[model samples]
Target: MKFERSEENIGNRVFKGALFVAGGRFVLRLFSLVNLVVLGRLLAPEDYGVASLAIVVIGFMQVLSDMRVNSALIAMREIDERHIDTGFTINMLRGLLIAALLFIFAGPIADYMNEPKLEDVLRVISVVLIFDGARNPAFTMYQRNIDFSKEFRRRVAATILGSIAAIVFAVLTKSYWAIVAGTLFGRFTEAAFSYWKIPYKPRISFREWKVFVSFGGWLTLSGILSYFTQTIPQLLIGKYLGASPLGYFTIGRDVAQVATRELTGPLVVAITPGLSAIAHNTQRLRTAYRKAQAVILGIAMPIGVGTALMAKELIAVLVGAKWLPATDVIVWLGPTLAFTMIASATDGLAMAKMATRAMFNRALFVAVVSTPVFGLAIWQGDMITVVYALVFRMFLQTAVNMYFAKTLIGDSFFSPFTSSWRSLIAAAAMAAIVSAVPASFTPSDPEYVVLLEMMPRVLLGAAVYVLAHFVLWRLAGRPDGFETKMLEVSGIALGKLRRFRRTAN
Candidate 1:
């Protein structure tokens, strides 16, 4: 009975945490949509592309600097002030080193890409490295304690301020410098807030140097490999396709990443702490994995498919005809986006099991496979061909990552895929229905007409898909059963609350 009560408490906590993360993500995404729309119009594609070149180098260096130690700090059990301080000190040093390197390499990087203008942009963005590195490691303490309320506030504030700064600078200067400046400002603000909110100060001590380096070594390698897997395409494009075409490619990638990051990121952040808490309990780990997979797939598969189907209309309507070329890129990359989302969830499973070496090796494989494929595509000298290469590479990488994750978790590689197949099918049907309804409703004003026509189709499609999911779950004998379990858990939580209230009385 005590065990049952404890299980109920765990379920309740998980439910609440998931709700907060999901809600926060939705709000943040809305803000991001606004930011993208404003920036897309305000800046030229060439400007964005130039900024992208600089960002690629800055991003790679930043990843190497941080080394995922902040995540490791949250994952560790029995963390102390000493651990927090050590992680903080390491992050600060790494950030300073990275900033210095970026400043030194700025000219060379710009010259390699043959964009002399990018030199200044690279130098300016280097400031973010130091700022981001100096952010308090104690910020993860909130996450480690499952206090997402603070996390949400901190992120939203940073995003809002950042978006505003970017838009303002873009309007004032009409240059890529605006984007880079906004990013630096946002990072600085976020880092300052993190330190202010978290109650920890760093002392200059490398007392735990051996332990920190040992763990961070594997994490840093994983970070570098992951950076290569993600950024190699941008590098290849900037090298071969020049700025404008790279801009188009970057737009497609960013659109897909926005969905992937916003939808899956919060879940990743929320799940790690829970998984860490249950790392030793195989049964609990399995339970969490199953539910997390189901929830992520239920949403991600439909989103990816729908985005693919609606890419042309959506981009034409939202970003204007200037972005219509991104439509093909979006469709080609959609499945990759979905698979990557699933892979992210699986990454949590690997981390929970402390399989950093396995994770590193898988990432390395992806980087190796993706880089040459990207280079080949660049050699082909076509934007669409480059996107196709990305699609193929991402698909292969996702499969490999998923296999490694399943091996670590003692599950079949196909388990998540099989579970999600139904949802994917339902979403496809919904997309078809939505697409058909909008065909006959075209009007003279393309944007307004598209929005008006799409509104009802979207509503109907969402309703049908959700209803179908529930019906299918019921027919499979899982509907009421899952809900009943939840209710039972909630009832146990209420009973405990009542007991506490009575004691206080």
Candidate 2:
């Protein structure tokens, strides 16, 4: 009974966390979808492409400036006011430096890309980095404390405001600069609102600088390498393929990331701090890791496979015909995205063990392997080749991360894999069946009509996948009593929802 209760608790935590994340992701993605639709109509491809280059540069620098300190802070078992103050100070200083650098280099960068307008755009976006850097480290504390309700409210407000600003500006100016302006406004608004919502205030004292550096330094290294690994492809594409092709690539990557972000990312954010709380207990850690893996894979694998199969219709319907090129890109990158979801689930173990160096090493290896492959692909002048290189790198990165996570958690490599393989296989089979369905069901009506026609097939695929997944799981020795585990997860989610309601009241 004790064992059962413990298992039940794990199920509950995962379920509730997943629900919170799923809900937050849905709202955020919905806002983004609306923003994209409006902006896509208003702005030109070249406009988006030019901004994409600056954003890639800014994103890379921003990761270095922030250094994932928020995550490191949340992962720590004992944190104090001084730690928060010192972390904020460090973050602000880093942000200031990076912003200044970008401002200074904006001219040269614009010149290199043969786009003079980007200089001002880059300068304007630097302000956003500074504001984001100035955010109170107490926000991390909120997450550490598992107070996502507050976080969720702040995020939704910021997103809504930002989306409105972007759409308004894009419609008014019909230029690329409006997108940059909108982003800056939204970010600064979020920083200010987040500070207002959270209780912690910032002090410029470096009193806990030593401790912050000791932990955050490793995180900073890992973040820098990870940022480079993800962004280098874009940078290379912009440089070689120029803005047009880079624009298309950026649009495709953004669509894929947005779709997966709401689905896979929120779970990581919600689970990591909780996982840190129980990190010292190997059994608890194993349970958390396994359950998180199962849930993420169960959702992500099917979505990814289905997205790959339905990329054309989905992109056409959602983003319009102008985005047709993104469909092929999404298809090629889908496998990597699926595997990446599983790899992210193990991050809690790494943080709990203070294995920052190991994480950094893995990220460095991926960056090194991928940089040359990306370069080669760019040199070869083919988008498909670039996509294949990305998939290969993702596989390599996932394999490496899994080895380290398994070593840390004292679980076999096959443990998490076996737990979800049945569902994955079923999802794949279901995807094939759904993909074979004809598009003739749609009459020669409006575009929205065609989208409506595709919905049934998508829903049918999902239903079949879920049914087949359950059947396969049961046949595979009913690992963890699949139905019981789901019930446990649902119960926990419900309890959390109740607690949140009570707290709200």
Candidate 3:
């Protein structure tokens, strides 16, 4: 409820804020699952292919134009209205220009892909940029203050409204247009609700242009290279491999990335303010960075391992038989996405210290190296090879990122492994149990039967993971780490529940 930052309960606020934002993202993911399931049944793989091409173009433009000023604002210790106004004005101008270019260039991009229908889709999705850019700058204020309950409401409302629009359109048209409609509606609703959540208006100003540019210049280069590293492969697939294959890859990649991203995004966002506040304290920063990375990876590793183990049944249950080819995507990309998030913690550390050139160099190296490697995969005509290539590229990048973190935090290169050793062992155990469990159904079995087969594996895997994780932690003498922190919190929660129950009785 408070817009001003408070020093009291800093730790509590960080956890609470992360949970609120994570809760909102979790709900959004549920809505997206509904869309994927229903639309997968209604539309063909080719529909996702066409939609993906358009999305790639729009995604590139957003990366090109984004100064990441909200990040700058959050990381900066001192700022005024001038910085806020400047960020808004830049976004507004960028949005208008990018939208115009997209509308004008849709034909050429589609022509390049040899998909004429893609032109209309690209043109329609361009409006999303305008809505995104015009969103209220006040939203950042809540984030900077580590308050997120109000933002959660806006997200929930937008998700419900946009999802309903998407499902209704899918039922009526049953085409790619339904996908376009949902995206456009979601961005519009989010932008509209931004103002309703806060009572602040921004003005057009460039008084703090130098400040933002200093913070974002290297980040811009880094973002552009990062976008290409991911997008080049996609565009190549669409052009060389074919639209249907592109559809499978896109759906698979998104599924893996979205679930992992939603899991890690809260800590990534909430930690920036905390990190920035102590940027000058190297000892504290090192400890915090190691522990935070440990906590995040500890939570993510098991989920990734489980998803890979159950990729076949998950694909069959969610997208049906025609999408079975995408199963390889889920298999490799699941672990890749999880590790990618673990590596991303290093980027936040760099940003907090205002040393973004390291990030830029890292992105440049990955992009330069990955582009040709991915191209070679496509030339081999094995899309499955591309998935393998993707895993290699990401893991290599993650190592590079860890090296950078070592430079920043004075930790060893293999600190990540050391920080989360318990998690690693537990995940391995979970994977072994799940994979050793015999399949209950053949590939030709009905979806319900496959679903039944997957459920028990999921449950058993989850149980083994938790039990193994705690036992390993206990065997280690309950060292002061994330596991101990988690158990203490659980105990506090249980005590509160008991007291509340007694009062109710």
Candidate 4:
């Protein structure tokens, strides 16, 4: 909970923090991906369908119960015992309210969804919110200080433990309850670790509740609006299309999201605090904002494009042929993932600037616009319509988010695209090259040939993308940007490594 002020360069600190977070995600998501693929093979589609509904309901309640106090604590320039205690108090109250609601509505929700098993699952998962509420708020100080290395350790350990637990349970039971148990155990581990890591005791107070509420009021509304736009697919998909189809949609969307979410999630986590550290300086904020977006898109654009191109093979190899129906959804959702990644950093920028009301307005616009389109698609009761609607919603959401973000940060609305066009073009070219590979080159179904065929194709595709991007950067006069900075850093690191090796010899 103690804060350490670093006299380091802001950009360096941000870059290092981002590296820690991204590295952690890469490791943890590998664990999670393995667990998911294994579970996908072990459990039936109906199990995921049930788990998806429970997750949506849980997320919906969590959204309604959001106070955004942790965010306020992160954004606030000054902090005190009262402020931290009030955040804890509000969290406990929010957790209790959400738990009570879930417990009471568990059966009703199960009945409404026509899934009798959800009642017990929902009740069990409700405890997660309480654990979340009881956690110390001062742990956020680590983030505010840009000490993501510690954050990285904490999250990676918890995720590994959770993944192991989930895999064990899935192997034994092969049921949706394994998913619920994994989720609950993960939250429990995180909460317990927060107190152990931070050495802060929770206390009840409302002295600073007004301050938190003042800053977080708009954010609370924004969270609620986001649930409707974001979780609507899980909520309504089952009702219209049945659990089996919803299961297909759920897995497809989950796998597709890894393309951008795993890459950008940590950067988004790092950027809010990083941007806040320099919020007073307009020039620094603008530079940091643009770089964050560029770096995220630079990594994420190729991932989305590559994943879409290899959707069929990836589903076949990773999650198995049983999930082939999910391939179409994955392909169409790729562009949506790309669009979301481009806009991911903007929310952090807005939070740093305390533009919560502007964020609320942006969310409201997306909700209002996307809701009816999503509804009409669901009304059609077809998977293709649902995919089209989801993609359309993502595009609309991105456009609105970009406009408001520009207004808040005083950047051009087209800045993201302009900064990342090279990455986009390179990714497209790489996908084309990979896709042009003849089926004759595709090896037969033995595991070795599958790895031989898929591995080389993927590697070649990635190499082409990197080479093309670099060539394009050179042709454009090698502008001073994230890619240039990354190259410089890598070169310096490599030189140090070589010198150290020579000294050791």
Candidate 5:
């Protein structure tokens, strides 16, 4: 599966990779939907809150410790087995270190959060990091050549199977352990699949230790700052507000994030190989980065804003009335995710150019400036105040990152307002039109009725967004961007289809 990176039709490869990854993620999200529907009912907010405690702790460790060597591998012009071994060794060492730390400090973490149940959970969840460390680093080789088949197969199969195990465990145990079980099973599956599929023996060697430290130093710093910026508010919420409210906040955030990330994250992944291929050419990389960011904003805004508009209906349909406390959380998270996701493109550009200090600065600004402000809000107000402060921080970060991204992207102003203007207007129009739909649902009626009403609004919102985009594109004299790129591909597809039909006849 490890093939030489192809220089042929890089754009097509990026598009196809995006579609392939996005398709796999789509299937994965369906399984997640099943889990949400089933688990949302089976578990309480407190159970979810407790589960978030273990997750955030592990995630904090993983993020802070990440060296991003795989990313370096993808961008490198050439790599060998020694490089792979070095990456693996670093991962394994980091995992064991994190595991030992968490094991020793689980008591203190639980004591701080005032959740006695969390200490046991953190100890058990530490096993997952071991599996994560053992994952096959060679899989990234496929991504370098625009090959996502192995990734697609392994992730989809693992998620579907893991979802089944989690549901069954939930039904039997009816505890937060089900969440822990699912995470463990998923990581184990990924680790086993990597070894089974790649058939490579990684060793405990750091022959390319200097190369890794050189490339990943800034990456590691950026990652730690990024993790702190994201997790600080959640940690504060758990400390000040308690587990139950944290549960509501996390659940709402998860649902909102899945909608935006699952759709547009693939595009970011898809563009990395292309960016790496053209890193030597400043103009092409900047152009590619700009168009990609614009597309993601255009696509994600509708998903995020529309989700905000449909928050009440979505919550009612997904989990039932018991979890209605999360409705406002989702509403706030929607627009917030829209703004924050723009940073993903800037991150990839920074990684490709090996100027990750720009990325580090992006995250560092938020972590340093926002933490005290968010802490003040947590103290003065409540969960909602903290949530609002977090949202405001992300919005500010987006603007700041845009300036950083422009420095890498060249001297042009890479403002979201300028690049994503059509999308902003289109999403606003769609939101305005869709807001007329009543958010209330009849609890006495069948659940299908809620879905039945929601179905039309979703479709109408989509139609309006597309129609608005097309009109603006035409009015702007057909600018070169994501819409143009999609159209060009569509034309090629149509031509092929027509040729095939004529030949068969």
Candidate 6:
């Protein structure tokens, strides 16, 4: 991982890689909004709840199969074709097994949930696991090479196609089947695009089987535990409270998750490869880890807080008033997801260091601690209680994981807080100003008119948040931060674009 003087521009490449990923996510969010808003209007909450439950089942199987082979591949100092072939062979086998399991057990799972319709949904969606398994494993090369532009294009196309499929299916059937169609189409596109985009072909080999398993075994365990921790609540809620309530819970969680999960997605994509590239240098690794957390929180914290404050208007405008029961769920989940993002981001640094044992232990602790909390929430049979349980679990998990990450990076526990406190303070100030505004935009008549009323409040809140954050950021003497780095990256990107245009001319 040592860089020669000629290769000292790694930092620049890292920034450029981040720009592509962030830009892709920016566009993908627009596609997701279209998917969510249109589908929300077309399908009932019960439809969404059923589809979501089915997805959770499929998702768990996929996670169980993910032995973290790709992550291991990226972390390695060098990986030959043998390693790649082994990873691919293992993946294909796992995919087939998971798909078969889904197909075979779909009926039993449906019976357990007491939703007979879910069996069909599970069988239909099981094909995605095969597509996922068959996808080219070479896409990690784009990440390892610090080139995300190609990855961005691949994702954007898939999202656009998937959103189109979802809308069309929703219009045609108006059943939960529409969501399943979109999910399947998206996975199939991603799997097909991988081989087309990369020069890799499927080949069966196990020459490096032990190498892959040794590195990925803990990752596989950790993935399974993490998925179960996150999804068990959805399962319990669907069983105990029924589909419509789970639908409301799911939608609310989705809206709140955008602030944390969606925003953090690209950051993780960029940073994991970047951090892996420099893992040999302890000092550099420490600095990168600290700065990354700061950047994520600086952007994510404000959005979470602001979204929490404006959940009512957001739900009314985006999701329609019939879904208003999810408002409280959104408020709590907004901050809950914020903490989860922080925890997940720190874990990425550990992954770069190959600290899977530590990572697994943390995941194990959270799973052990949170299972009862989720059970209690289900027992209470209230969506708000479920959200509160999640918030509490995330808060505890963040602290424990940060402690483990701190040990690896040799950084003090306070480093993240030092880098991130300004953003929190700024968000608080912005929230105060936005909250003081009159609550005059709530519509009393038709639900569709609520969208018109929500526009002004949303615009006002966004305007105030931006102005307040920037003013305070500057007044604090403008430390080296996400804003400064983003401007530098944008300048580099613009210069490159201009050069390309010149060459074209």
lDDT measured at residue 262 in model 1 versus the true structure, 0 to 100: 70
lDDT of 4 at 213: 83
Candidate 5 colliding pairs = none
**lDDT (10s digit) by residue, model 5, range 1-505:** 4546867788778888888898889988988988888998899888998998889899988987888878988888888888888989998898888888888999999998889999999999999888888877877888888877778888888898789888998999998998999888988898888877486678889899898888888888888887887887778888888888888888788777767989998898888888888888888787777778778888798999988887767777777767778888889989789866665677667777888666777778878888888878888748888888888888878777778877886746555556668888888999898888665566655568888878889999999999999899899888877578768878999999999999999
> Could you tell me how far off, in angstroms, the CA of residue 154 lies in candidate 1 after the best superposition?
0.8
TM-score of each prediction:
0.90, 0.92, 0.96, 0.96, 0.95, 0.93
Which pairs of residues have clashing backbones in candidate 3?
Answer: none
Per-residue lDDT of candidate 3, residues 336-403 (tens digit)? 77766666677778877888888899898888888788978888998888877788788888888999
Clashes of each: 0, 0, 0, 0, 0, 0
Q: Sorted on lDDT, highest at the top, how do the candidates line up?
A: 3, 5, 4, 6, 2, 1
Q: Compared to the true structure, candidate 2 yields what TM-score?
A: 0.92
Q: How would you encode candidate 1's per-residue C-alpha lDDT over 187-297 as one tens digit per residue? A: 887898887745567676677666677666777788888887777777777777788888888777767666756776666667777777778888778777766766666
Tens digit of per-residue lDDT, candidate 6, span 127-217: 9999988877777777777788888887888888888899899999999988998888888888878888466665899899998788888
The TM-score between candidate 4 and the true structure equals 0.96
lDDT score at residue 410, model 1, on the 0-100 scale: 83
Q: How many backbone clashes does candidate 3 have?
A: 0
lDDT of 1 at 323: 70
Q: What is the C-alpha RMSD of each candidate to the true structure, in Å?
A: 4.9, 4.5, 1.8, 1.8, 2.1, 3.1
CA error at residue 197 for candidate 4, angstroms: 3.6
lDDT of 4 by residue, 141-229 (tens): 88878888777877887788888889989988989878887888788888877777576776889988889888989999999998888
